[model samples]
Target: MESDYSSAKEQYAALGVDTDRAIQLLKKIPVSMHCWQGDDVGGFEHAGASLDGGGIQVTGNYPGKARSMEELRSDIEKTLSLTPGSYRLNVHANYADFSSTGFADRDALEPEHFKSWVQWSKENKVPLDFNSTLFSHPKASGLTLSSKDKGIRDFWIEHVKRCRKIGEYMGKEQGSACIHNIWIADGMKDIPVDRQGYREILASSLDDILSVKISKDYLKDSVESKVFGIGTESYVVGSHEFYMGYAVKNQMLLTIDMGHFHPTENVADKLSSVLMFVPEILLHLSRGVRWDSDHVTLFNDDMKAMAEEMVRTGKLDKIHIGTDYFDGSINRIGAWVIGQRATQKSLLRALLEPSEKLMSYENDGNYFARLALLEAEKTLPFGAVWNRYCEECSVPSDLQVIDEIMNYEKSVTALRG
Candidate 1:
């Protein structure tokens, strides 16, 4: 079958990538949504501070100076105006609500709100991707299971059931309309010597929760195709390793967040392990510190190396661009877009460059160039209209949209040759 270049051009133009070739390149790229509430707990303190209780101290950042819905809508318009094809705007359930002790204090996610949000998102022509929907204990400080944490375990079990219920309901009605996002905030610190039981409990809960999918068949034959994602966290691993088992058990082929793994922990090996197990891996793109801290996408040399390795190893196929930006700022939106663009360009260059004797070891393969071409030909842009509204006032309009993207393309292409 002949590839229609005109259709491709139209599609790319819609997403803000102007060049016909760039659009064509972006056509095959998979884009997914990432969701987060600006803050999990609105100004408060952890009373008594149970291991699984909320322990946040009010840092005076509340009532987070956010933009009105109108501003957000305008940003959405701008985003869609650039990339007009099918893309996802990932969202979470707790953005406007609060939770305590592993329970969403808001009772249930209001049906009206969900419908309205989904409807509004579609009206803006942006598909919604729900993340952390099943993550029930946003208000909790840490999640664990022990004789001391039987309470936490009880909460964990109940939370899992609650999430399963939500998945079932949403699956029945609007499940197919959006992606079913999953990430675990369940882990504990200052553990007792008996770690075996802790691992068993967490792993069992995860298995049981995953089983909900099969029983409910949320992804079975829904009207809207649901995409499920699992995330990794640096804090998850320790000397004995509480998170390694959890990571190993994520057998489903889904999205992988780039910033979740830390370099101090051998990110390359962790990522490689995930890739090896999950045949179909979708990457969540973001930049983080190698030592500690997921401080947004300020590029680093180690990350460049990791990205280069992932691409060359054919892991780019399961990748999607994502920004784990927590701060409510217009700059966050811009940073997400710019960061992905810059990272893609830089990685493309690394992938495309011919074999050189720069490293101690080398592989005689054309895979790197091939991966670069694949990424260049098929990367998709996500529209973060809501984030823009939250941070629009503080951000400086440094460059024209076209100019920024063009520079991105040139930089990536220059690195390519």
Candidate 2:
């Protein structure tokens, strides 16, 4: 293994790339793993409250979906064990630990409601990010923040405010800014008679929610947009235009999910433009087939392009990376590991990019040579560098990791009754 890496390192050096520096640099970037994946987006807020109203639909009935916070944390621990480098946890408001008492509704939630989550983070040395739960609740059956009904709109606004407070508490406890992300399911299944009206209300509700003064030292707020969702096949209130304008005007982070756009739209192309205006960016890495926007991530052309764009931006600190996919057909823990591994590997390959020569070729209008070099890059010994990185991170450098996941499923998740 050492010999292989040594040869690869020398090869990369010939292209003005430092493999050692790239490895060390990639280790410092934290990837926040989504907690909803562990339980198919099911939360403890209500009994048997599966994913509803949200464009999201978790299809698989894989045994041992986390029934409680304890099981979920245990599963997350298993996931972290397999994935290399730094990581944080992303939790929705619905996933709030209600096990302390009987239950506390979303609007009434406080930091105390998430005591278990905080303790778990401290125990595992993991940081956390928070999301306002805008789906599956009674008020969410139709529209939430954008609902014309004053009562329903106010309810959701209060819920988001509380969610931000929880994010602040989490950030303070973890001593890192907790990314408070806002994504709502307020759209029409068909062409709405009042698209502008709904958007107006949504903007107002967002203003009310963001009016609260949460310090950036603790909470970094972001708004997420989607092109369309299951029920929102026709029009989404928080379309890319809505959130992009809001994020830019408000100087907040804009979350760009890869699967949240037209199939032909490349997320990689948006980064350079979005970064120019927004203060920072939050990335929800996901892959959808045609319309479903929550497929397990893979190291495909789309992912590679996104990673390369991020590295070329020269603003790693301004980016928050997180995986946002759920696959019920496979072991849940294995799903988490697979997505994160792809996320890490994509960035690792980008970090090892020979940008100098590639850029020079382009600047000199040597397009043919540039294309030739890029095609040649695919044949490089990237596997050697990746293997060495995994070995150092104490994870398997080969497919044996799958065997480990299988062993865990048999012993842990499969035994769940």
Candidate 3:
């Protein structure tokens, strides 16, 4: 394997590509892993809470899903062992650790509710990120934050406020900034009489929520948008335009979820434009089949294009990359490993591109040569470099990862059933 990597490295060097530097750079970029995939988005808010309410849905009935915070952490540890490179755990407010004591409603939540998670992150040496749980609650039936009923709106606003405090606590404890993302499933199923009224209310509600000042060093805030959801097929209150303008005016990070836009819209194209105004942006990397289905990510063209654009623009540090998908049909740990590895592979391939040479060709007006070079870079030995990276990181590479997952299932996950 070393000999093969050496030969591939020399070949890449001929094209002005440094394979070793690419591997090193890839190792430093951490992909935030979502915790919802381990349990099918069923948080511990209540024992039998319906998982079908939110604009989101998790398909299949895979066995061995984590039923407690301990089990979820165990599954995450196993998944992290298989995945190479650094990572952070993205937790939803619903996943609060309230096992020792009784349940606390969303409005009553505090930093104590999530102390165990902070400790677990510290022990694992992985940072924590947060999301306010705006779905699967009673108040979310009609609209939250934008509801005409002021009481319902106040409930969600208080919940989000507490979530921001918790995010600050996690960041302070971990000595790194925790990104607190806000997303809501607040929209009407049918065409409404007053679209402007709902947006105006939502804007006012957001202003109130953001008014609670938390240190920017501890908690970074970002707002996410959606094109359409299951119950929100007609109109979405927080459309892309609304949040884009809000994020720009407020100087907050704008989160772009790949599944939240139209099927034909290229999210990669929006990155350069959005970053031109906002200081930074967050990405929820998910694969949408026809709509926002949240399928497990693959090393497809969309993934490649996004990674290529990030590399080409020379703005890798300005983007926060995170995975956001839940596939309940397969081994949950395996799902995490597969999606993260695919993302890392796409990034590595993008790093291996002869971008500078291609740019030089274009600058000289050699369009045909530039096109040919771009096409030829695809056939390079990317897999060889990827294998070497896994080895350097001391993780199972190639087909060996499958065997490790199977072993884990037989030894640990299978016994859960």
User: Model 2, stretches more than 4 Å misplaced?
Assistant: none
Q: TM-scores of the models, in the given order?
A: 0.58, 0.98, 0.98
Candidate 1 shows a clash count of 19
Output the lDDT of residue 354, model 1: 31
Q: How accurate is candidate 1 locally (lDDT)?
A: 0.41
Residue range 1-417, candidate 2, lDDT tens digits: 999999999999998999999999989999999998998998888877787666668888988788877888899998889888899999989987776676878789999988889998999999999999999877788999999999999999999999999999999999999999999978989988988999999999999999999899999999999999889999999999999999999999999999999999988999999999998999999996898888999989999999999999998889999889998878888888889999999999999989999999999999998999889888899999999999989987559779989898888888886
Candidate 3 per-residue lDDT over residues 1-417, each given as its tens digit: 989899889989999999999999999998899999999998988875566556877888888888878888999999899888889999999998887767899999999999999989989999999999999876777899889999999999999999999999999999988999999988988998889999999999999999999998899999999999898999999999999999999999999998899999898899999999998999999998886558899899999998998888898998989999999899988888999998899899999999889999999999999999998888888888999999999999859889999898888888888
| Cα error of candidate 1 at position 279, Å | 3.4
- Residue 114 shift from truth in candidate 3, angstroms: 0.8
Candidate 1 vs candidate 3: the TM-score winner is 3
lDDT of 2 at 252: 99
Worst 10 residues of 2 by lDDT: 47-56
Alpha-carbon lDDT, every model: 0.41, 0.91, 0.91
